[model samples]
Target: MSNLPQSLSLNVPFGAGPSGVVPGGAGSAPAANKDRKMASAEQLVLDLSNTELRENALLELSKKRELFQDLAPLLWNSFGTIAALLQEIVSIYPMLSPPTLNPAQSNRVCNALALLQCVASHPETRMLFLKAHIPLYLYPFLNTGSKTRPFEYLRLTSLGVIGALVKVDDTEVISFLLSTEIIPLCLRTMEMGSELSKTVATFIVQKILLDELGLDYICTTAERFFAVGRVLAHMVAVLAEQPSPRLLKHIIRCYLRLADNPRACEALRHCLPDMLRDGTFSACLREDPTTRRWLQQLLSIVGGNRVSPLQSGGGFEHMMVN
Candidate 1:
């Protein structure tokens, strides 16, 4: 233990027996002293200001897979210090770009973060991470267009951190991701990246759009889908080029959901020929009543009084009634 300031060692009752034992017992006092000494040793580790040491301790603790009861309580009590350390850990990202950590060290860091994320599941730590701008630290890697093995590991770690942050629902973090044009960045990344990256990006976009905050941000991304018809067309074109049945289905679903907005419906009408040709749409037409209804509504808006065969020319007219 380092030199203790007076504030850390002001207590005067040093020569006491075990807390519950009688003071006159021959060995009891020494036992109590030993316990106090052990406790003070643990406290000293907790109080250490060297973040690297603390990080190493946390890494070891995580590897042991021991109960967090002891450390969690202490971290909660000294939350300010823990938060400061987290901030410092996050700040190291700039210096550690393309992080120098080998696989083992990376695993240790990730496991430590996982444990901290569990500890920080409470509102206070969430707020602390937000206040410290932790998301900014993580976002850079997401934005990094690195393809090297080292950068790939950092990217994976960054994504894990993002998952942990969002799990906290730190609104500041959410707002930052939204406000900083992350959605568009993600979309572009998906547009240019490999199939796996695109899949992850699509999942992320859908997840964001499912949330109210994310939906609001998306709506604000373009003035209206009609006004950004070219961009919408580009998106449709990208989907049209893909062969994934599931992705096409999701894209159609998302378009249908967006079509509930009059402007989005109008913008989507321009792509109807391509959409109708998609195998997913053909599959749905055979099985999904909702798809039929959406197609009807879309045709009503796009074709006006012009009746399509399904609407008036066949037994399918009765299918809708049933």
Candidate 2:
């Protein structure tokens, strides 16, 4: 049950304690009273053994963006508790081990990650997750190879958090992501992860390549540009073997994003011909109009047609034939 006063407005300060003022900030009597109430409510939820109860309590609290934004220091201190609970559910143990999600623990882990994701959605609050190294805790849930019920769902949810962070347009978050191994992990998942995992990975990869904040990071240097190119090429190369229709579609969309950047386009310019010619991509082009349209656009950019639907809204959709 929430201890928040019925009259205390949700319109609290950007970083108020729980739902009030911070411990040190202008510690007025009323604000201190509110902070103590908030801390108690949080402690109550944290004490509950039922992960769902914790999720519901946190869920209700997280609805107030100010809780994360204003009380970041106080809120960030909770990340360790979150990480511990997360470890219990996924059994990844400090994130250095392979995940082995027990069926019983699956739902709880998803709920906790959902809570973490809610915090990550706030641009200012997202730094808390990164500073707490939450990604390290989150990524291993995706390791379960099973595509059936829970594991696949967990993978999708984990990827969803990363994708959401990308959209937040924060430089610190983007910088942290670029520094981590997450990019390679997403690339691998995009190529061969479970069907839904592939979809989430594709979104994250596309967001990274196309998100404006990411452009500076992705295009900072020749080697960085080339690294992006190499990763894109490798995704295409993976298509050569298994060549799932769905996977091919995701990769094609990612290329459409790639085509938007002049730097990425130039780095991938030569690879386009081989990719377009690849038996898998070519076959998909013949059968799927969406794939056909996107590939044509990518080819046109690399080939100097520079047709940009985002810019000119032109006949960029026109299909190209061999």
Q: Evaluated with lDDT, which candidate comes out highest?
A: 2
Give per-candidate clash totals.
Answer: 0, 3
The pairs that clash in candidate 2 are: 14-70, 15-70, 15-71
* Stretches of candidate 2 exceeding 4 Å from the true structure: 1-84, 87-100, 143-149, 211-250, 260-267, 273-295, 304-322
Q: Give the TM-score comparing model 2 with the true structure, all chains together.
A: 0.58
* lDDT per residue as tens, model 2, 248-300: 77677777776676655655555453755444467645778887788777666
lDDT of each: 0.50, 0.60
List per-candidate RMSD values in Å: 10.9, 9.9
Over 4 Å off, model 1? 1-58, 61-116, 119-124, 165-173, 188-201, 221-257, 271-277, 280-322
Alpha carbon lDDT at 304, candidate 2: 38
